[model samples]
Target: MIGRITNQQQLVSAQRNVQTSRALLSQLQEQAATGRAVTKPSDDPSATASIMRVHAQQRATEQYGTNISDGTAWLATVDDALSSSEDILRKVRDLTLRGANEGTMTPATRSAIAGELEGLKSDLLEKANTTYLGRTVFAGSSSAGTAFAATPAPYTFTGAAGATVQRRINDSETVRVDVDGAAAFGTGTGSVFALIDNIVTDLTAGTDLSARIGQLDTHVSALTTQHGVVGTRYSRLQQAAQSNLTQSTALEAQRAGLEDVDPAKAIIDLKSQEVTYQTALGVTARALQPTLLSYLQ
Candidate 1:
C-alpha cells in the first residue's frame, strides 16, 4: 500500500525551500554590492584564510618598505656630510701645497695660510658633528650632544666609540646608515683637527711642511674610502626599496584574487535564486489550495 500524503509536510518543505532561496539571493546581492566573495568566514573558510595570510604579509612588506625609506634618507644625510668634509679637506690640501713652497714665500704669507687652515679645521669639525633630526649621525651610539669638542689644546671626540648605528630594513637585513665621527675624522690629539693645528704651527714658525703634506694626503684618502662605502650602502637600500614595492604589489593581487568577487557572476546567481524563490511560492500555493465544490453538493 502507498503511504498517505500530508499537506502539512508539503507546506513546511516548500516554505523551507523558499526561505533558503531568499537567503541565497540576499547573499549574492551583498557580494555584488561589496565586491567581496567572502563577506564572512562562514561564506568561504578556505578563501578567508588565504586572504588573511596574504593581508598579513602585505602589511609586513609595507612596514619593511617604510624602514627602507627611512634608512635611505639617513644614508643620504650621511653622504652629504661626507662629501662636504671631503671638499673642505681638498681645499686644505691646496693650501698645504702652497705652504709647502715655503722657500719662495714670506713669513706673512705663511701666517695668512695658517689662519685659513685653522678656519677650515673648524669647518671640518662642524661637518663631523652633523645632525639629522637633531641626533648626531657620526657619534656612533653615544648620547653626547655633539661629536667633537674645541677645548683642551687640541679638539677631542666627545662621542663614544666601539659601536655602530644601523637601521633594520627587513626581517633578516640590517644596514648601517650612520658614520663614526672618530673613525672618519680621528680622535683626540690624533684627529684631523690636531693635524691641521700642527700644520698651522709649522707654517707660522716657518718650519718644514713635507711630512704634514703626506698626513693630509692620508686623511683625504680615508674620506674618499668612506664615501665609497656610503655610496654602496645607499645603492643597496634603493634596491631593497624596489624589491619591497614589487612584493607588496604581488601580495595585494594575491589577496584580491582570494577575497574579491566578480559582480557579473553574483548578478547571475542572484537572478537564478530569484526564479527559484518564485517557483517555490507557486508550488506551495498549488499544493495548499483546497477543492471545495463537494461541500455545496
Candidate 2:
C-alpha cells in the first residue's frame, strides 16, 4: 500500500530548501564583497597551494633584486677606483717620458718632476685603498681598516689574501663584487708604489729610465685587465636583474589568477542567488499555510 505524505514532512522539506537557498545567497554575497575567489583554504585547497608557492617565489625574487642592486653599486665603486688609478698612472707615464729626456734635463727640472711623481704615487696609494660602505673593496674578506699600509717604503697589502666577496642574484647565480688588491697592486716590494718610488729614484740618479718606463707600462696593462673583469661582472649583474624582474612579474600574474576574483562575474552570481532565495522564501510561505477545505477531508 502507498503511504500518505505527512504535514510535518512537507514543512520540514520546505524549511530545509529555504535554509539551503539562504546559505548559497550568503556565500555569493561574500565572494562579491571580498573580490577574492578563495578567501580561505577550504574554498580551494589546490589553488591556495599554488598561490602560496607563487608568493614564495615572488619574495625570493624580490630579495634577489635587492642583492643585484647592492652588487651593482659595489662594482661601480670598484670601477671608479680603478678608473682613477688608471688616470693617475697615465699622468705618471707622461712625467716619466718628459723626465727621461736626459738630453735637456737640469737639476731643478729633475727635482720638480720627482716631486710631482711622488705626489702621484701618494694619490695612487690612496685609490688602491678605496672603501665602499665602510669596507675596503680590495681587502678581500679581511676586517682590516685599509687594503694597503700607508707608511713605509715597500707597501704591504693589509687586506685578506684570499677573500672573495660574492652576492647571490638568483637561486643558481652569484657574482663577485670585489677585486684582488694584491693582484691589481703588487704586494711588498713588487707593488706599484715601489715601482713608482723606483722610477723617482732613477730620475734623481740620472740613471737609464727605460727599464722603469717599461715597468710602468706593465702596471698600466694590469690595471686595464682588472677594469675589464669588473665590466664583465657588472654586465652579468644587469642581466640577472632583468631576468628577476621578468620572473617576478610572471609569478604575480599567476598568483592573481589563482586567488583574485572577477568582480563582474561575482556580482552577476550574487544577483542570481538573491533571486533564487527570494523565490524559495515565497514558495515556502505558501506551502506552510493551512487550507480551509482540508478539515472536511
lDDT of each: 0.85, 0.89
Q: Give one digit per residue, the lDDT tens place, for model 2 in 1-297.
A: 998877678889988999999987887788888888887888789988988898899899999999999999999999999999999999999999999999999999999999999999999999998998888999987888788895663698998767788999999889999999988888888998898888899999998787778898888998999999999999999999899989988988898899888999999989998999999999888877877654443
Q: For this target, which candidate reaches the highest lDDT against the unseen true structure?
A: 2
Per-candidate TM-scores read 0.89, 0.88
lDDT of 1 by residue, 1-297 (tens): 997656667668878888888888888888888999889999989888888889889888988888888888888999999999999999998998899896787988998898899899889999998988787888877787788888764667877676777877778999998887877888888888889988998888888888888898888888888889999999999999988988988988888888887778888888888888888888888877765742332
Off by over 4 Å in 1: 152-154, 289-297
Predicted structure 1, TM vs. truth: 0.89
